[model samples]
Target: MTQSCVARVTAAYRRIAEADRPEVWITLRPEADVLAEATALDARLAAGEPLPLAGVLVAVKDNIDVAGLPTTAACPAFAYTPEADAPAVRRLLDAGAVVLGKTNLDQFATGLVGTRSPYGPVRNALRPEKISGGSSSGSAVAVALGIADIALGTDTAGSGRVPAALNGIVGIKPTLGLVPTTGVVPAARSYDAVTVFARTLTEAQRAVGVMTGPDDGDPRSRAWPDDVRLAAPSRPRIAVPREEDLAPLSDGGRAAFAAAVKQVEAAGATTAVVDVSPLLLAARLLYDGALVAERYAAVGEFIAGDPSAADPTVAGIILGAAGLPAHALAADQERLDRYRAMARRALSGYDALLLPTTTGHPDIAEVLADPVAVNSRLGTYTNFVNLLDMAAVAVPAGEADGSPFGVSVVTRAFEDQPALDIAALLTGEQAPEPLPGCGVDLAVFGAHLSGQPLNHQLTDSGARYAGEVTTTAAYRLTALGTTPPKPGLVRVGPGGGAPIGGERWTLSPAALGHFIAALPAPMSLGRVELAEGRWVLGFQCDPDSAAGGTDITEHGGWRAYLEAAGEAATG
Candidate 1:
């Protein structure tokens, strides 16, 4: 039998308790209460209410308010319970997601190395000896460990993306103000973005989509522009930094990034190497220049009030902001504006920019030996993102010497879809197609499903999305042993079959022939029955393909299968 939401929550609790990574959480909800919330969600689903994130559990960064939970920012002296939920948390709750608890962070969201908290350094999810990357460390680890379906992290200076990259997960650092930061404790307020971390880009996208738009109390919050319609371009022009700019990368990191770049180029996108020295210089300003004053502006008073309670390194960095001359802040701001203009002109010709997420992955002991230096190194690729007001998605590119390697796809503010489109290409998933128009309705399964690896094949072939529909409980999905990991759908007898997830695309008659002619063995077009009793031409795999493949019928879809596989590896 399928697990109920309550059962999943209960099991997750047991796994978390056994995992015993105490440093990852500053405050956790009572197990009974969390299970009860899941039960309530299950009840709502049974009543036929529409909940996009029904029964999903999430972790809140300690810096954000969760109504009754303490917003500590991982600083014991700063802990406080809020009377109201953060606007972002409320949005997720309203979408049928439940909060598991508050995860730890760097003290007052001050550092990127994840070890500034009194709660103890956050250990990497896969490599315990390595730094988790912070100030959003715990939030990323919670999602990576499969303890949360989604987690919220604030990105002031790569806090969100860096952690996700280190932990091998998807981080959606939405455009500034797109997701309200009203209830968040500010860390350079102008640059702080409420980011979502999840195992897959689609999950992060869904959660983030719900949290976007204006929040009354947040002066920085704004609605997405009318012109920036959500969509993925069929073909994209991606920018890569010049070779010399990437010299800081470790050999393994460089090789992993090169492979990812090759994959993107093979997928039909054009890449151009451009000098980003000005952007790199701007990144230095985040810590080395007057921008550090913003940190002082946000938390200096707290450090001054109780100096002994602060982490030595975090306190030093914050306190150092005190003597910064006002003229320096103004000068750096002026300098940053120029850099932004330079970056805009540099990226104007491309849809998005692709870069290695981090230059290095340091171990916890190494970070402890030289906290500031190692932390600074971790932000080489991330620090410039929020300052430039761009949207970025960090996806796990591959592993490097037993550690996760990540690549970030960035685009100008509000043009998030193109970055995501390229991310799907890098990960071998299909980019979701735009809304449908006149054409023949054709059902699709496996990698061809919208937003899966091969969805671009349809969109590139001039197919338009018709709708998403599910199949009857007479089909099974299998994971074929293919190079890019495609799935095969097979019809089964009623007693053993299960409902399968799929999408419908509208393709012209002429396009359908070309699509089929290019399809490899074991996959062919055939009639498929929808759950609603309607029939449509769709993908089907030969029996021989399923003979040697793993039966993934339990996942109901390829996306779910991949997510499950990722979670299994984490355990």
Candidate 2:
């Protein structure tokens, strides 16, 4: 009642309804439910409780199961009461997040255009006549409208990212197995992933960290590597698709993408134009190849059982799936595997691949006129990600014609941290204030570490450099072989060690991705204990990669070593 964040947001929701209500949500939480959750969150905060997502209200795409809610997946006949929350939903709840209600999506998660839903197309939050990209339509609009801090969505193709791009929000689709897909209605199980949408990368990442991790029940869930730490490279190498590959982009989208590249370069990165045809081809296979059958497999029986209950558009798509022959499916699977290998090989040389989130933004009417064709076009860049086992984070670059423009940072699986880091850089969303009462401290070194060549990398990754800090005198510094000149400080022992240098930068997991991707070879990230007995993410040298590097521990820090080298040369 004292105007809590949740209350203010709820009130705003009502006001928007009174003004010019767009069909953003298919179903909303009852007033009683909203008030109860808000009261509980307020009490928890007042009691000084440890809540990771204190006062954060999140919306769930209707396709995802929320306990005590009906999951229609845009098809009312398919609606069912989920007695238990999905794995991802349960995690958010455990983190003290309040669920507002379920939002509209493309029926059965079959289309990228939000209009396919029987409940009514979700109009773009910025412009009501425009389509809100889907199948994560309502989730994106909810976040963009400030009705929720973050929203849960499913991205098989561009469901998660497309909506975010159209609505001007951050959409993060982690590695294929990074976030479990349990409890969400599957569109294409193998390609399906639970995604996060939020107004800020910081908020989005906070939700991701709380939701991610291997679940025993989910066969696809895998353990995260222990060595993986969210730290940026001294100089990141990002690959941009060649102009020819982006031919499908409208003039405005192309210009926005170019501007985003400039931003990445301005942040002290090297951008190399590369051909992305192979990736594009793989994306095409999602609908063209046997993968369509997978979509049918998920709900083919349900649709057949109750034809009247399904959305017409959804029925047509799934019906097409039924006709896919076994031989064709087999051939398609083989081709997909081949393409996946090629993608891995092509992406190995770059930290991450950057591309526009969508080639074009169609209005709701345009999408409705030709749903399948327009929806397929939207997924041109996104469909291949999960198939290739890649992680991606979509960040707002700028606006095009009053609509939002966004770029996706893609990397090989497990490199999710770096991709998010790079996205933060492009979006210029670094240094966000921490949630109230959260004591997590971040230490940055290198470009994002503070006062270094690529320092913007840190700020862009949403990291606030706490200050300079020294290692516990147990570290050795080496100038690893890198293009922009990088130093790796390794903790060797507890005694007889030098005061190895670095900065203390605190950031959420999403910010950490941008930082990690900027890391140059020979140097990698690791956990280093600070002199104050605090453990923070820091850099380490791949011992093998540092074999012939210079010992710069005598200089105490990377900056000092570089300065001394420059002076020696001048002399």
Per-residue CA lDDT of model 2 for 1-571, tens digit only, reads 2457467557756855764545667677776777777788878878888887766888999888899999888887778999989989999988888887898888888888888877788888888888888888988988888777799999989888988888889998987777788788889988889999998888888898888777876788765653343444546789999989998888888899999999989998889988789999999888887789998899999998887877777888787889888999889889988998888777676788999998788887787788788888899899999888888889887887678888899887766777777787876767233321122355544444466676776555534446688878887877766666677666678885687667776665545665478666666777788888878767777666656887778888877887888999999
What's each prediction's TM-score? 0.77, 0.80
Task: Give RMSD to native, each candidate.
Answer: 12.6, 7.0
**lDDT of the candidates, in the order given:** 0.85, 0.79
Candidate 2 Cα deviation (angstroms), residue 104: 0.5
Query: What is the Cα-based TM-score of model 1?
Result: 0.77
Q: Best by TM-score, which number?
A: 2
**Poorly placed runs, candidate 2 (over 4 Å):** 1-22, 431-467, 470-571
List the lowest-lDDT window of 10 residues for candidate 2.
431-440
RMSD of 2: 7.0
Tell me the tens digit of each residue's lDDT in model 1 across 1-571.
1567798789879879878898888888999998888888889889988887877789999999999898988888888999999999999999888898999999888888899999999999999999899999999999999899899999988888999888999998888998999899988988999999999877888888788888889998977553353444466788998889899997888899999889889998889998888788889999999989988899899888889988999889999999999999999999999999999988887878899888788999999999988888888888999999998989999987678999999888876766777788977766644212224678887888777778887766545576788999999888998867788888886656899988988765667777778988788889999999999999999877787899999998888899999999998
